[model samples]
Target: MVVLVLTACPAGLRGHLTRWLLEVSPGVFVGQISARVRDLMWARVLELSKDGRAIMVFHADTEQGLAFRVHRHDWQVVDVDGLSLMLRPHEVGGQSELRPGWSSVARARRARRRK
Candidate 1:
């Protein structure tokens, strides 16, 4: 099985994907396809996406039973201890900062003790 998520891509790209994959939701596509076809589709996405971003997740025989491919996305895939993981960037400028939702709601009580 393959899952593809696209963001900010052209409408034609999404329409093109629907031929082989089901558009379960807007910008989200899923289907079972051969590796050759999947690769071709990914190439097509990269060609047509322009300034957009896309992520593809597919079943594999690895430790995680899945693999990922990302294009023009801030989050990245990394290998750690023979495992694949998504690395979330810590800093926030154009992107939102990574913070615990609970503590982010308001100033943490612990901050008062720092002074």
Candidate 2:
């Protein structure tokens, strides 16, 4: 299974992706295709996503059941000890500066304690 999600992309790119995958939602596409085809589609997506964000997730043989990649996005999917996790982008100085929300600060504090 392969899934690709696009945000703030152009219409032409979205149409092109629709040809290869089903448009389950406005910008969400899902399909099962060969790796070669998927890679080809991703190439197009990268070329056309300008200023937009694209995320692709697929079934893989990795330690985690699924593998995911992001392009031009503020969030990222990371593989840690066979578990897929999401990490938000932070400022260069420190993450605390970017996460000003009380909940995020608390969560960060807890994460620090765990470390």
Task: Write the residue-wise lDDT of candidate 1 on 48-111 in tens digits.
Answer: 9999999999999999999999999989999999788999888768655745445644355556
Output the number of the TM-score-best candidate.
1
Error of 1 at 64 (Å): 0.8
TM-score of 2: 0.76
Q: Per-prediction TM-score, please?
A: 0.83, 0.76
Residue-level lDDT tens digits of model 2 in 45-112? 99999889999999988777788888988788876788888887667555455544359778888789
Query: Alpha-carbon error at 99 in model 1, in Å?
Result: 8.0
Clashing pairs for model 2 are none
- How many residue-pair clashes does candidate 2 contain? 0
What lDDT score is found at residue 1 in candidate 1?
A: 99
Number of the top lDDT candidate: 1
lDDT of 1 at 66: 97
List candidate 2 stretches off by more than 4 Å.
90-115
